[model samples]
Structure formats: structure tokens, C-alpha cells
Target: MKLSCTECGQGRSITDPVWRCECGGLLQVEQRLGELDGEKLRRVFDERLAHRNTPYASGVWRYKELIHPELPVERIVTKYEGNTGLYDSEPVRRFTGVRDLRLKAQSENPSGSFKDNGMTVAVSQGAWLGYERFACSSTGNTSSSLAMYAALSGKASYVFVPEEGVAGGKVLQTAAYGARMIRFKGTYDDGICFLERHAAELGLYVCNSMNPFRIEGQKSIVYEIAQALNWMLPDWIVLPGGALSNGSALGKGLQDMLATGLISRMPRVAVVQAEGASPFHRMIERGLKELTPEPRPHTLASALNIGNPPSWKKAAAVLQATCGVTVSVTDEEIMEAKAVIDRAGIGCEPASAASAAGLRKLVARGIVDKDETAVCLLTGHMLKDTDALQRYVTREAADAGMPVSSALELEQVKERM
Candidate 1:
């Protein structure tokens, strides 16, 4: 399939290295109206030459023809980033008041976040295009994911991180992946703004959600959801929102599935943003046709601390099409939800907890019904914020006075059982 400008309708392909419209708008996949036959798609997957080396037996590769039909079956990069598992948790149901609640455990991905879904595809596509280096601006999750995948593919990587964001596990993970780091003394949004203006000059590909390939990769999440649920569309999907790119891509993915007849209906989308940065939430509350922000958006969920989302135009369309509501969660609520998620044995960062918290709030307000099947997207691993996690645990331990020792130290000695 050829990629066309979302704004101006210009087209590009793997042969074209310059992935943009002449008018400067980013490109989107040019899809035609149709439906995918599951049996046929499955057969294609079963016969894939690259299936042996891939991570997930079913990922975008399941719909390989849609992504890169022209490329050889063996040439596509397949790290099995997609096909993450979905778990039905009683704790999640008890907290959200939705009887049929499912958790999309994206933190289980190789890079410990949902960003791997996009990064894998971007890396594969870049490799197919014969690029030896890749670059992206990230809050943390994306750069780490890209670094790991790029290394796996023998590609050099460059990542930009905000100075304030350099204190967490994400920063360590990026360095661990061997990516050359560039620290920007600004917010994640500002770093992205800088990249958008200078990346082309630097000859580096932007692997952020601003890139269309990111959405192509992210569509696998929806693919897995439909496949796992036997093609049943949930009543609603609750997800954390920073840039709103994931939600926007999710909506577009479902729309692609619908067009291909993979699913009969689309789920209503609910956007969950941190209260500290609730511009999107505010805009949705006022029913604003346009999603323009005032200024200075900040949030504890560092991954979503973007004030000027590059994908806002597409995000606005997603909210409108799904009639989705945006809910803002406070730092306190996010922390509380982190405890809830930890207790449930699925530890995630505050951003991931935001979705769980938002859904709980919706149920409490009676905005979402108990009968509706809901899915909360857990976007990142709690370990990514070990400092914050350490603080949280230390405070709890101090209040309770529970004995604390290093795991290794405890393992070296025996306790009286």
C-alpha cells in the first residue's frame, strides 16, 4: 500500500526515503474499502517464511500483505513486539465496576512498554529501506524501545531525552540499549518540536508517534484484541493519554479492521490524561470542535507530558468518531491506582495506572455502565520508575515499620519459617 499525505494527498513508498508530503503534512496509509478474511489471513501467517524467527506467531505479520506485500517474506524485521497477552483480572473488575474487564499488558513487551509495537515496525521498515541508523525523540519509553530494537537489527541509534526526564529507569534503559543520548534542557514536547524542525536536516528519521510507521505498528494491538476476543468489539477501551497518539492510532487501527471486515463494530474510546496536564480533557468537556491548547501542559506521567501533540488533528477525529470522553486523573489518584495495579500483580508506571484510575472514576460517576466490557491499556512497566517505586515502597514501609533488606542479602540468609 502506498502512503499518502494526511493533509495534502501526496504519496511515497519504500523507494522514497523522504517520507513527507510536499505540503509538509505527514503521510497516512492509503487504505481501500474491504474486509480481511480471518481464515485467509491465518493461512498466510502459517506459511510465512519468516515465522520461525519472529517473536509473536501473530503480529502485523498476520496481516503482512497489508503492511509490506511488496517486500520479500524474509526481509521484514520480526522481533515479536506485538501479540502481547490480555488477562482477565478480578481485581481490575472490583476496582473498575465493569463486569467484563480485560487488561492489555503491554508492559510485557520486550522494551517494557507499548511503544515497542511501533518501534519494531519502524526499524523493520527502515532496514528494508536500507537505512543503517535511526533516531527518535522520546519521553523515555520510545527511545528505549527503539534502542533495543535497533541494536537487535544491528543499526545505530540516537535518542533525545529531556534533562528532567534523565532521573528515572527509562534513562538507564536507554543507556543500556547503547543509544547515543542527547539531553535537551526542556520538556518532552519541546524536544519533539525541536526534532520536527531539525531532524530532516540531521538526516535522522523521527521514530516518535509523529511518524506514520508508528501507527502502522501500533495497529497490531487492535489486531490482537480482536483475535483474542474472537472478533468481538468491547463496549469501551480506556487508555492513558499524553500525546493522544496511541488512542488516535488505536481508532485508526479499528477503522482499518472495520474497513477490512475484520470486526463488525468499533468500541467507544475513553481518553485518560493526568490532571496536571488536562488540556485535552478540558477541550473534550467543553465539546470544542478544535483541540487547541493554551500553554504549559505538565504531568507526572512523563510519557504523556506532551502539551502540543503532533497528532492532535487525528486525535480530535478519533474522539469525535467514537464519542469518547476524556477523564483527568490526579497524581494522588494515579499513585493510588499504582497501588491497586501492584496489588493485582501487574506493576506499571503512573501513566499506565492513569487508565485504571480513569475507568474507576467513570464507573463511580455512572458515566460507564457495569455491564459494558471494558479494556484498560497498561502502557509501561512500573520498574521504569524504580526511584518513584522505591519512594512509594519506602514510605509505606516507614509507616508500617516493615523490615526492609536487599533481596540478595535476604537470600544469603535463612528465615525461621
Candidate 2:
């Protein structure tokens, strides 16, 4: 695999420590191979999955032919990332008013978010590149994943969090992984800027999604979803858009899949964004070519509170490729979706439920037909942002139709009863 700039066509070996080209364009993983044999590849991946003893059993590495195909097995570092659960919940189906709904929960991953899908490969690449130190700026999930992967690889890790920061749960997850925590006095964009400015001087390998390998790894999510459904393409793929890396990765994966003849149809990808932090959605709504960051991005789902997503260029490319559109939902919508998901016993973080909220919005708007097969990618676990859940369940910020009290149980027996 080689890294190629999206804009300037600059090329370098994948092992190079370059996230962007000299022309300041983002990089993507480019393959130097003949036509991919999708059928043979699928058989090979199936063989690996059947063998419980092999490293190829990892959902990401199982499709390594499409994901850093040349990386040696021994050189890879994995905490068995990926292999997250994909469920079809009747309650969620009814709540979203979508037929044939599938929820791809990345929360089941080792690091508790879709970031682990990328983190495994990116950190492995960092190790293979002989980097001894690594760093990233996160709203929460990215930092937590980076810290865990860095620790597993025996590399020093640094994480820059937003000044307003994120839920203590995620911050504690990062700290528990032993990464040196640095707080910048601004939003996540500012934290990213700070990391980029100091990363070279500090000799730290940047492991954010801007890293092409990181984006490449996340494609496994799409791959897994396709595989779970016996390689059939759903009518729609919905996901929360924060940094927008996951959407871009899914789009690229579909392109590759089509090239390899894995699926016969392309799914319309819908990137769900929080209304408070919906610059990408606004750009789409206005039919504008240029993207502008929101001056004051605000959302209780801290993970999606990014004003300036570095992956915007790649993400926009994804939308163009899949004929995808953006859907922004309010925090109220997200929390209500979360409540339904929680009640269904398929829990997700607040931002993760944006996919459900957007699905509901799209269904109501007639954008998504009720009978269409759709997959909603849930990005993180409920515990990743416990503070948000606390507020909801503790009745501090109940939604319009939320249940005020739970059913009476023996644990809380009343003398009057």
C-alpha cells in the first residue's frame, strides 16, 4: 500500500510518517495490484474466521487484502478490535419507523467506539514505522482508543482534550490507559491545531483519522456489515458525523467493494450530525461547495461537537460518491433516540444515537422509505459518556415523551404499597 494525496497526486510509501502531502492535501491509501478477486477474497476471509487460532480472525485483518494487505501478520498489533455486534432490534425498528433495520454497534469493540477499528491499524503502522511516541486530539473516543492501542504497543501516548473537554468517563478511560493527558483551552479543533503544531517538534506520530491508515482501517466496519448480511448492500447506511472520518471511510470501502465485485449495489450513505454542530449539514442544506466551521458548536453529545472536522474533504468526497446527504437532528432528538435504544437494551452513547434520530427524521421527510433496508452505525457505548445518560435518567433533562418513573420493583418496595 502507498499513500497518495487526494488533491496533488503526491505519492509515498505507506510506511512514511506523512499525514498530508507537501501541497497540504490529505492522503489516502492507494493499492498497487491487479483486479481484486472478491469471491476468492471472501473465501479466504471466511477461512480465517473459521479458524479461531489465527490473527486473521480479527474482523479488520480478516479483510486485510483490502486493508493494508501487505502488512505482515507478526508485525500487526491487535486487541481483537472490530467484530462488533450487528443487531436487528424490533423496538429500534419501530422507534425509527424503518423496516429491515440493522444497528451496527461499534460500542462492542475493545475501546468502546468505532475509533478502535482505525486505532488498531494506525497504531500497528506506527509501531511498524518504529515510532516510540504517539498523540491525538479528541472530543473523547479517539483519545481513549489511541491511549489503549498505544499502551498495548508499549509506546508512549499523549492525548489533547478540549478545554471544555468531554465526559469524565471518557477522560478517565484515556487516563486509565496511562496516556499523558493535556488539556487545551478551546474546542476540539483548537486541540487538534495544538497537536499538529507540536507533533513534529515532540517527535510524536500523529494517529488521528487524518492519518490515511486510520481511515483505511475503519473501512472494516463497512466490510463487517456487508459480510454479516452475506455481502448484500443495504438500501441505506446511516452514521453520526463528528470528525466525519467514518463516513468517508465507508464511502471509500464501498468504492473498493464495487471494484472487487463484493456487492452489486451502492447504499445511499446518510451522515447524521447534531444541529448544534452541523456545519457539514449546513453546507449541504445551503447547496454550498465550500464548508465553513460553526463559530459556536454546541451539543450535549460532546463527541460530535467538532466545528472544524479535518476529514471534511474526504467526507464530502464520500457524499459525492454515494449520492449521500446530510441530516442534522437536535440534541433532544438524539437523547430521545438514546432513551428508546436504552429501553430496548441496545444501548449507545448520545452521539451514536444520532443515526437513529436522523433515520427517524429522514423517514418522516419521505427521504427514506419505511420498507427499505437500512443500517445505523452506532459509534460508541453508553458508558463512554455517562454524564449525558445520568442527566437523562436522573430526570434532569427529560425529553417531551419520556417516562418519569420506572415500574415498581422489589428493590424499592414502598410501605404504603
Candidate 3:
């Protein structure tokens, strides 16, 4: 595989210690898959479902040839990440008005978030490069996943997060995994800017989605979804847009599958950003060629509060390639969707609920057909951000005027019931 600049079309060796091209464009991995047999590969992937081995056991590594064909098995650092569940929830289907809606619960991964899928590949690639330290700037999930994987791989980890707005559970999880936490009184975009400026000087291997290796690993999410559907393509793939890395990765993976004859059609990607932090959405709505960053992005979905996403260019390309749509939803809409998912016993973090809310909007607007098959990706587990849940419940209770009342006697309780 070779690293290719998204803008300048410059090619560089994969061993280069650079995240971006000299022109400051993001780098993407260009893999060389020699004459892949779709049917044979499908059978092999199906058989590996029961392999119980090192690489195949991991959902990301199960499709190693497509992910990182050059990486050796002995150098892999995996926690058997991926293998997350896909559920058909009646409430979610009804809420979105999509009859064939499948919720891809990525929260079931090792780190309670989809970040583990990318972290395994990124950390393994860093280890292969003989790096002893790894680092990333995150809102929550990325830091937690990085810390966990770094601890497992015996590498030092450094996490930079905004001083405020991050969920308590994510901070606790990162600390528990023994990462050196660094907080700044700014946004996640600020933290990422700082890291981009000083990561090389500090000799840190950045494992954020900006790292092409991370995107390579995350592509497995698409692979797993397709494999679960017996190699059939979905009509739409809905996901929350934060850094835009997941959507970009999904688009790339789908293209790869199509080129290799694993699938025949492309799924229209629908990326949902928080209304307060919807630069990409605005760009699409205004018919702009470039994104204008939100100066002070605010959202109840902490993970989607990034103002300037680094992967916007890649995401834009994906949207263009797949006839994708971008939309923004209010915090109220996000919370309402969260409640629906929670009531259905398929809980997700606030950010993850954005997909459902966005899908609902798309369906209402006639952008997405209710009869078409769609897979909504829930990025993180509900427990990842208990603070958001607490606030949501408290506000809901206040708005509804006390959902419960004290009952001193059994008669009173019975009467209330």
C-alpha cells in the first residue's frame, strides 16, 4: 500500500512519518489488491467467523487483505475489536419510518465505542513502526479507546481533550487505562491544532482519524455490515458526523468492495451533524465548494461538538462519490431520538442517536424512502456518557412536571399506579 495525497495526487511510501502531504492535504491509503475473487473471499470471510484464531478472530483483522495486506500477523495488536451486533429494533424502525432499518450497534466493541475498530489497526501500525508512544486529541471516545489499546500494547499514551464539556465516564475510562491526560481550555479543534503542531517534536505517533491507518481499520465496519447481510448492499448508511472520519472511511470501504466485485451497488451515505456544529451540513445546503468552520460550536452531543473537522475534505469526496446527503439536527431532536432508542432497550450515547434523528428528518423530507433498507451506525455505548443521560432525564422530568412522586403508603402507590 502507498500513501496518496487527496489533493495534490502525490504518492509517498507508507513508511513515511507524515499524516498530511506537503500541500497540507490529508493522505489516504491506496492498497494494491491483486485480482480478488469475490465469491471465494466471501466464503473465506464466512468461514473465519468460526476460526477463533488471532487475526481472523478480530473483525478488523478478519479482512486483513483489504485492510493492511502488508502488515505481518506477529506485529498485529488486536483486542478482537469489532464483531458488533446489528439489531432490528421495532421502535427505531417506526421512529425513522424506515421499515428495513437495522441499527449497527458499534458500542458493543471492546472499548464501548467504534473507536476500538480503528485503534487496533492504528496502534498496531505504530508498534510496527517501532514507536513507543502514541497520542491523540479527542472529545471522548477516541481518547478512551486509545488509552485502553495503549495500555494493552505496553505503549505510553497521551490524550488531549477540552477542559470542559467532555463526559465524566469517558474521562474516568481514559484515566483508568493509565493515559497521561492533558486538558486545555478550548475546543477539540484547538486540541487537534496543538497536536498537529507539536506531535512530531514530542516524538508522538498520532492515532487520530487523520492517521490513514485509523481510517483503514475503521473500514471494517462497512465490511462487517455487508458480511452480515450476505454481501447485499444497503440502500442507505446513516451515521453521526463528528470528525467526519467514519463517514469518509465508510465511503472508501464501499468503493473498495465494489471495485473488488464484493458488492454491485453503492449505498447513499447520510451524515448527521449537530445543528450547532454543522459546517459540513451548511456547505452542502449552500452549494459551497469548501466548508466554513463553525466558530463556537455547541451541542448536547459532546462528541459532535467539533467546529473544524479535519476530515471534511475526505468526507466531501465521499459524499460526491456516493450521492450522499448531510443534515443537521437540534439537541432536542437528538435527545428525543435517544429516548426512543433507550425505551427500545438499545441505548446509545447522545451523539450516536443523531443518526436516528437524522434518518427521521430525511424520511420526513422525502430524501430517503421508508421502504428502502438502511443501516444506522450507533458509534458509542450509552454508558460512555452518563452525564448527558442524567441531564436529559432531569430536563425531561422538569418539563413533564415530575414523572414520579413520593408515596408513603401502599394505598397511595396503588392509587398513583
Encode model 3's per-residue lDDT on 89-112: one tens digit a residue.
998899999889999999999889
Cα lDDT of model 1 by residue, 1-417, tens digit: 778887777777745655467897767766553545746764555455256555435466666655555666576666676667698889868988898999998998888999988777778877888788788878889889999988998889999888874337898899998999998887777777787778768877778887777787787787778777877879999999887779878988888777766778889999998877777788878888666663666666777776666777677778778888889899888888888888988778878999989999999999899988998999998887776678778988888755665455554455411
Residue 291 CA displacement from its true place in model 3, Å: 1.1
RMSD of 2: 2.7
Predictions: Cα RMSD each: 3.4, 2.7, 1.5
Question: Which ranges of candidate 3 are over 4 A from the true structure?
Answer: 398-409, 412-417
Once superposed on the true structure, which residue ranges of model 1 sit more than 4 Å away at CA? 18-24, 33-39, 42-58, 403-417
Give me the runs in candidate 2 sitting further than 4 Å from their true place. Answer: 396-417
> What is the C-alpha RMSD, rounded to one decimal, of candidate 1?
3.4
lDDT of 3 at 416: 52
- What's model 1's TM-score? 0.91
Candidate 3 lDDT (Cα, whole model)? 0.92
C-alpha TM-score for every candidate: 0.91, 0.95, 0.97
By summed lDDT, the worst window of 10 consecutive residues in model 1 runs over: 408-417
